[model samples]
Target chain A: MLSIQVIADVWDRHLITMRTIEHLHMFSIALILSIIIGVSVGVFIYMKPKTANPVLNFLNIVETIPDLALIVLLLPILKLGAGPTIAACVLYSILPIARNTYTGLKSVDEQYTYVAQAIGLSPREALMKVRIPMSLPLIAGGIRIALVFCMGVVTLGGLVAAGGLGTVLQNGIQLYQKDAILVAGLWTGLLAVLLDGFAGMIEKKLHERYGTW
Target chain B: MQTERLFDRIESIQFKGITKKYGEGFAVKELDLEIIGGELLILIGPSGSGKTTTLRMINRMIEQDEGSVTINGIDTKDADPVRLRRNIGYVIQNIGLFPHMTIRENIGLVPKIEKQNKKDIEERVKTLLDFVSLPPEMFMNRYPKQLSGGQQQRVGLARAMAMDPPLFLMDEPFGALDPILRKQLQKEFLKIKNEINRTIVFVTHDIEEALVLGDRIAIMDQGELVQVGPPEELIFNPANELVADIVDNQRKFKHMDTLKVKDLMSPFEDKYVLEAKMEACDAVDEMTDRDLETAFVFEGDELLGQVEIVDLMKCRDRGEKLSELAKPIKTFQPMDSVAFALSEMKNSGEYLAIVMNSKHPVGILVSDEVLLKLI
Candidate 1:
């Protein structure tokens, strides 16, 4: 008969691998969607600031909902798994990226815009050619922060038996399998750390290119 | 675009009771003026004097609270801002080349947006680059970041000229350069303007630049145009103390025209025949045939001083040989301005200053000639 510890070790190894992959999977989708939706919404608000306040206030209200309850409520409709998990992750990611985008684009120097116009560029031409290039670094930084935070939420998604690292953690909890829980926790931490480091390097490179904070 | 052919005849611009207010007070108040075409007009004043505000009103960049600006007999209030702006070229201190675009792309931008063919746009860009002396092969593909400030300003100039607009409004385009470079560029631009004659409305606070470039200058104070006139007229007779102070500094540059050697040359000086030591005996008679009153003797190519006929006659009486005189001829340096030469002439109390190249006297100018030309 296999020792319980031996079974626990096998569960621990499987949980580690699954959790790492799940964290990457959930965060990646959320981050990519946030970039597209966030940049668009940010640019829209930047173009018309008068209408942006109410929309930002609405997003602020949505952010007030508790993360776990929000996930559970989404579970019934999305039927648990990667879908509901991704939706929750994406919802959490937009606030920072969208806000950053709006602020960054809006803050491009007016003199730069005036120069572009005096040189005969239309408004859209000036924004795309001058303002956006200058503002991208700040927007990218916000996305980096959003991605790291979303990874943490994704591991929590594993609790719904979504086959993420949270599955091993939950199963280990049930049987008092200390090793299994430890491995699952270790992998989740490593995953968040590696992703964050990657994003940080990219953000730094972008900031250097655009000379922005 | 040549000045005479600009719309067959010059069109006069009229601003009718133009008023622009930020809040309670007016930024530009009930101002009325007329601007004639083919003239280089400079608008100058202190900060917040509405000089820029007035220029912007010409193209309607800022909406006037109450008033109408008419250009070429058309009411600017009813015209489309974009269309009006396109017809007029505008340049600012920043030289705003699009950061992401190549020089060619920035210069070619308006034509591209207007749906011109690729070939035509490329041709226009190349032509403009050449006209600005920034060759296309060297600068066309380079980004703005790669260019120096002066080069970028030239690119800005090229971009403004791309549309072949009849009117150009420049808001301190060279205001950001260091003074020396700014002066050099201003002088260089005069040569360029001689070739391309478009109606130019320039804005600047520097009085020297205004005096150098302006055919007519309009001085503004608190958004009001206090006076406008030709540079010479403005300097001699200012509208008030403000105008007088602005012109007082420009008087220095005017001295450049008065300091020529030809202006100081005299007609009545004893003529000296300039001759080489190797000149044959027949050449001595040749000098006398030319009605020489004196002879300037030389050794090989070196200048020896004046040998008067009286001195030679006295030498003949004493049974002595003819020789070169040891006196130095007063001379004016070629590069010295007429004013400096005149001052030097006055200081020395000399009737003439010899115009020279190094130690050689090229010509001579009298005090009376220099004084006549000073006016």
Candidate 2:
């Protein structure tokens, strides 16, 4: 029987802690950049609905490419490391955020926009004040999905020596260390659950504030 | 009224040889019409007959492909579309109160956009809420989703009037409501318009609504202005077959002008008067003795209001004076038609209409008497 001490020892390792921090840093940076790019693209497409299908299709195609293949494809330009791994994760994250944003914006009641125009709000003002605020719950939902998704894919960072829980699992498997593998996998799962729960809380709060729920 | 002077500035909207086309066909073709300021001019037609197109062109929502639409001789094209729209009130059938905004915020939007002071905006919102008959305290904090359809449309109207714009464009504003609510709103709107005196271009396909509400009815067919005139003129002297056909459907409203309030109302008498300081018990006793349901409560010759026998009986203090128990009277000039008086009586839920000559109450038109005349 594996002792609790064994699991505690692995959890206390400085190297694992460092890897966890690095994993969070990469995930957060990529997620932030993805959100900015994704939401911007979404707003652009919403303004001109004719471009929606083409743009979403292009992103859909990117999503279809395997995660490792996309990382490797970026390797030629960004080279192997945290850079290419984060870039690939960001690319993967964009599809959900962009798609959800586009759908949410499109779903906003057009009557409000018509009133916005009739009342003389410039189109830009209407989008910012009315459309975006009204679509917040759906937009936040998209962001939450993207965040959880990025957390899972970020584990793959260890494959390129980018340093995350994946590296611990990889070393454990290579050396046939059962306790090490179990601890690493368990922590990664816990981290994902924690981040997803946090995102869910945020989404709930946004919906409540906007009274959209 | 403050709104009376607001109408004097902009006399009318003139459309001169205006035309708008979509693809191959004209949406509105060579429309030449004049809408008098301070009156509700209803542009009514069948669906796709260009009533909406004409209304939109006034606000520059849909730019005219040719000719000009002028408000008080200043062409709409000369003004910035956004600025011009800000100065015009608009209401649509959907009653688009922003779901995200509270009723207070929705009603105060245009004033906020105009950069009015916060105190002024708040005051204006309260005033508009009262004007629309929605109590501020109960409705101001509630969101749009919290309101019923009729309540939402009332908020929509209050929002439109936030800036007190001289020109209003209502595109089937009450078309989506149920019949009962629609009639109630129509009456409320007529009352509001009478006080505000703003020029209004209202579009509707409902012939009854057009005939009942419009100061002048403009009938359109196939993007052409078939005729424009007062409801009575259009009924008595329709320009063509189409006009006659439309008016023929609403023949009852046509006979309204034949009898004036003077002909219908009974002359004022000392028996109908009650001193303001008279005790509630005494007032009730007097009404009971005369078998009267209502009597005008007066502070010597000046009409304070009217007191109902039911209201006087309900007074907690038998010693309370009639002045304390009386409700404000709804007065109309003797020149007003019996149709107008009956409608007013129906709307106010009052059985008596105080017919005034100048400011003094000359007569009282009992609801039963008017009904008898109509029968």
Candidate 3:
């Protein structure tokens, strides 16, 4: 067995490298896909609100389930590991973004819409130029929330043999290795804080650009 | 300011039996009206009277369930909506500027969308800024948030005009502002409308605004046209009692054009000018030298009556208070016709009004100032 010091020596070297890269890969994939799915779902809900209500309700139900249990439940169908873990995180991220988009798009002032129409802008043109542009700040805010939530969930997702800091954390916990656990948990926490802060800056920039409070 | 020639292309609007129905009741029904080219048409009505619905129908923003709206000569239905909108300018009360864009970008949007050259768009944006009284160099780079409400409105007007649309649809664009700002913007808008000569469909609830701005007024009730005519005709001869009440409230303000100092100027009588504490003694001496008989005792242009030699001696003898001694100066606005001046003189019991711009005097409205020269 490798001495604890040797594992410590490699901890910053091999383990951190693998954890950070894999963490980034899984986080990015989950975030991008979730955004795509969430926005599409949001747009659909916007266009067909009656249809959206039921669909959104179902997603809200899915979000209510505990993340670890949801992953374990997914393991039965997808057979464990990164696939199920990433899938569960993506599911968790959907509610905030999708709901946000729907609400934002719906809440744009009716007068602006009428004015756009009076200017002879077509339905599509009004939606793209007036409605969508006006809703961007709120939509972006929702996306930021969803992204931070996903980042946190994905770090925890490493519990399921996913190749991220969660893997290091799980091993360190099982093996009673204090240094190993400290490094993974601490880095994951730091990355979450960093990502959250970055998303916040982007949100502020968007609000300033769009003249939204 | 390019004054669109008085006879430019005769861009009239005609609505033939237009009707809009929502479920059981009609919003507008069988509405027939002809809007002349280069005329501002103000549409006034209580809320839910379908005035807005009618405004929207012209641009097909709200589809009329029946009849046709023709611009120039082309039926609105046949015109492609996008292309149609490109040829029409729209302004709303809230001044809905695109939040994400700078003023320049907002004004140049339709041009940019049509793939106009960048240089042309820039030039047009700059020219439009100057036309709207906003300096391009300062406002062009600023976003809507940086602008005040009135500034945003002017930008909105510039954007609407950028495409040089022959028709303008304004839905109470100044209604949200405070009364002072609304009046100022209304005056500015009149100047702009004169410059552009765009056929306008202006909607408002305030009768004073309607009479002040409209060449022809269309009053609507429950989606029906109650009356349509020049403001004078509407006021003098209303189609019904409802129309009469609206015109009644606006009558006093409308009489502004009828009141003039020339109609009521009493005269520059009294051998000597007023000698008041406010007036420098040397200034009084100068008036005496000029063969001006009566010095009108004025407390800052409130023409205190003629300071006759008798009143001056009374001041010297009894020491009359300046406020009591100063005569009331009758005033007349440039727009006020002679009739109003005579009435104001009679009612105020003062031959002259302190003609003022706001609170400060501009000129004396003596009785002789009447164009008739009766004074």
Best by lDDT: 2
What's the distance in Å from true for residue A88, model 3? Answer: 1.8
Candidate 2 lDDT tens digits, A1-213: 458888778777637788889889999998999999989998999889999999999999998998878877887788667888789888888888888888888888787887898877778878887888888888889899888878877888778777778788888888888888888988899999999999999899888867462
TM-score for candidate 1, residues paired by index = 0.71
Q: Poorest 10 consecutive residues of model 3 chain B by lDDT?
A: B366-375
State each candidate's clash count. Answer: 16, 0, 36
Off by over 4 Å in 1: A1-25, A47-66, A120-122, A168-191, B1-10, B100-105, B115-123, B135-145, B250-338, B341-375
Instruction: List DockQ for all candidates.
Output: 0.17, 0.37, 0.39
Q: Which 10 consecutive positions of candidate 2 chain B have the poorest summed lDDT?
A: B1-10
By summed lDDT, the worst window of 10 consecutive residues in model 1 chain B runs over B1-10
Against the true structure, what is model 1's DockQ?
A: 0.17
Candidate 2 shows a clash count of 0
* lDDT of candidates 1 onward, in order: 0.71, 0.81, 0.74
- The regions of model 3 sitting more than 4 angstroms off are A1-10, A76-81, A211-213, B1-10, B250-375
Report lDDT (Cα) of residue B97, candidate 1. 74
Q: Which candidate is the best by DockQ?
A: 3
- What's the TM for model 3? 0.76
